[model samples]
Target: MPAFGRTMLTHWHLDPQVAYLNHGTVGATPTRVLAVQQAFRDDMERAPARFLLRELTGTFPAPWRSESRLREAARSVAGFVGARAEDLVFVTNVTTGINAVLQSSQLGSGDEMLITDLAYGAVTMAVHAVAQRTGARVRTVSIPFPPSSSGAVVSAIRDALTDRTRLAVIDHVTAMTALVLPVAEIAEVCHARGVPVLVDGAHAPGSVDLDITDLDVDWYAANLHKWALTPRSCGFLWARPDRQADLHHPVVSWGRDKGFLAEFEQHATHDPTCALSAPAAVALLREWGWPQVRDYIHNLAWEAGRRLTARWDTRLSTPEEMIGAMVTVPLPEAAGSTDADAAALRLALLEEDRVEVQLHASAGRLWVRVSAQIYNDITDIDRLANAVRQRLVVSSVESR
Candidate 1:
């Protein structure tokens, strides 16, 4: 309906001087969404006790309200993700939601928690912590990098599940690799082995069309701050109706015995504006038309991968179907192949070229993960391409 690319940059507060290709890392919120969050904060400060105790959670009755502000917001978000409000609750981020599920799991000495190597580092650490606390063990399944097909990913997880696997954690869209895993198919395989699935959908909400109900997983954790245009520190967890009874919030607070929604709603006092302002973010998505927005971003990301790989003389191993609004492309061998090299190259891109992107070393080569958003265009990709090439030339000269 409206123009995308630099013309759409007016809606966000991102610096014009920097070519930002890192939207998937920590999302950039739009100016309008921030203003809406500020309004909620202003209302909360006016009557702190009434807002927090009486009206925010609706656990206790308020004279003028039929539902809590939090539940109302949850309902809005649930609809967006094709979930029921009663089955979903807000958490600070994806890591928090996954931790809550991990802590509540019924595991014994021989039990195992299965996760893939592609999981976010924080999630991997959280699973390890749970295993340490309980007598359980963590088993990592390594999905082949630059996987040939989605079936290969599903098969890897299927082969990894065992009788001891009490839970299987998978990613809807991976972090470092930027591959969109076949979660539904993977869930089917895990379910056959009687293993419950928990999906870390951190990069999924805004990047692709999502329906939590269709995923067939026991639990789904995702962020609204990243692709959904919400302010920072807003994420949600969705549980099947049958799974809710056994789940507990990570923080034990006033609503301990109350239901799943109540347990998460009263997880100690913290800023609630990020969650409260989520409805505004959903509204913006509707205004833009989700399909149009998704397509524009996905196409741009694919184009970026194509152009960058061709320019760098490297290959894009992941197929287009497995990519969403972000794609990971390998850098030339000249970029170096260690974590330190990746870090130094990233810093150079930012400091020298004002082009910020996510870089990591994987499969014996340096790779750049480019995130395409509504405010980005081919010019940004060209900037990144030119900058990296310049670095390669400089490296070649110095080495001789």
Candidate 2:
């Protein structure tokens, strides 16, 4: 977007004063895409029977055509990560997608599901619930701070792996720490030892340039609602086509006939507006083009990281190449990013700095994760950094 052209930003109606650095927290949809979605919703609402029953019919090809359009936006999503399109299925969000895969999979009493200590809390609960049902054990690769390399991540996960380990679930980017794991190497290690890898790429989709087909993980789930910058209910689970039979939907609906992908798309419909909006969201991204957008967002985030790194006590958790758009900066010991506190820093920044960010604790470290999108700029980062510096300085003296 051009600096002078009010047209770009005027396209959307976000609060002008709030510098939103938290695109990672359910993306802010562009006005154009959302407008299209609302139009679809309005059309559906106006003549519910016409759009839902008559137009959609029972045959999925028509609605599936919309998904295919979204898919064409990039098979690189799976391709880059090292998976095929046949292996992938859509869901409303990663939680739903991951839960579907976990609950329906054949994990049992003697089976174990491996995960990282750094995983998103909600996902951890989902994993535990499935374990509760199947009597599977939940083991984690404890990735403490000072984790130095891709090798370190791989080694930690490898050590956690045992003969009973049915699946190893790792994060492409840790939601709390913004840390990226060496999933490809770990995938290779797991595959060699007869374990399947499930990647939680909740933050990867539109935030980073992803190619799932290139990654060796047997199962990958991503939330288009988060980084993908699509609507709230868009997410996907892609499995190796061969493993497709091994997996089933968390919700058992009309999918026994064709395959898992069909199963996901045909999820029961009271009215399919939210899910149907996904194609329009994909269309918006295609219209904007990420080449310049990625570079722009990266530069802003990198500048923010540089600012955070300049502080004496603060630490940077994410590796350079690993974190393209999101950067995690460890806050001082006193801060907390969880909701009860309103994440003082996050709220203060939003209210005062007009800069929105996410503050959370992971690995015993408090952090503020910064995210950037087409709507963000360097000035926004500057605003956030300034507010953080000002507050921490006061906090420093209060501690004394």
Candidate 3:
């Protein structure tokens, strides 16, 4: 708010012209952090022998510091969600981490996995795969639109759980609605029924306050690339060390067959640049001041949502308490608007308006979910709201 010292945009190589409101898809890393990542790559290229063999093959300070920084980053994450560092494990992203839990889980014949309609599409496939391997059943709970309260969410999940339910996958923040769910309460409900809850926090890391260890859930994973502003394909999974054995590595990399931490940590060779730059990601959050940046984004999202009401019939599916930085506000669904039409509308926003936002089908209707990050301000969001209203008006007039 203070003279825009720096929007998160300058962090990455994104063009300065675009007003990016799509941090929910994947985060834009800070320019400073990208420099650090390049340095690592350059060092690797200059002398593969010196960097890879002499330095990397053994224990290197950068990666070691990276790992330590991960723990510190984990500490910040754990502090918000209420968890310990040892309880969480860093994986590539939510997809890989989710698969690890599903494939490795000992679910057998007749096991049931309860998920909600709000779950991410990719994660749903993972549950299906688990069901195929074992004769497990997948039950999807349909969450109501314009979510009333966190209690309603908890009740919906509780009603969905049956005697055969062995696992439950929910969202810390629903990808479709961009609404935050009561993960802590959901975990408690699952534990009471002797079931484990796996939370897909795809948008939680940088968008909201996350305390991995204290969340009290059986397993969880979130994308650092989205909210935490890490490089793409960077995310992690956290389990109550006891449940670590419940999920196996998605790939049979070198990390397997080793000890507990070693098994997950030392997995196959990856472009560790993202992991190495994690400390800076965490540092940026602190540097910007987490609470200040968080409130700033959330307030902007609320303002934009309220402003849209004057343009079209709308509603808020994301609750204020549950929502932090991301807000999914529904737009009027044109009666004859086909999927193709919606895609065109989204493209128009990008190509014509230069406003980076999201348009997707959800809750049997289409909605534009607005993500507010540090780089976003009122002007950026107002541009998106105006563009949508303008297009819809033009289409209606043309139809006549």
- Which candidate number maximizes lDDT? 1
Model 2 TM-score, all chains together: 0.86
lDDT score, residue 280, model 1? 94
Best by TM-score: 1
TM-score of 3: 0.90
Arranged by TM-score with the best first, the candidates are 1, 3, 2
lDDT of 2 by residue, 1-400 (tens): 3542223566566777677677787577767667767877888788766565445434433553443433443353444334566576667778887787787678779889998888899989988988998999999778875467778888888888899999887889888667667778989989878998888888887666677777867778888777555667767888777778757677777654467665665557754454456656655555567556566667667767877667535766555766667777776665554554436566677676777788765555567788867677666766666777788788879989
lDDT of the structure predicted as candidate 2 = 0.70
List runs of model 2 lying over 4 Å from the truth: 1-8, 54-86, 256-258, 311-313, 333-342, 362-365, 395-400
Off by over 4 Å in 1: none
lDDT of 1 at 205: 96
Q: Summarize candidate 3's per-residue lDDT along 214-298 as a digit string, tens digits.
A: 6788788877888777777677787777786545787876657664455666556666667656667777777878778777877
**Cα deviation of 30, candidate 2, in Å:** 0.2
- Provide the lowest-lDDT 10-residue window in model 2: 67-76
TM-score of each: 0.98, 0.86, 0.90
List, residue by residue over 162-220, the lDDT tens digit for candidate 1. 89999999999999999999999999999999999999999999899999999999999
- Count of backbone collisions within predicted model 3: 13
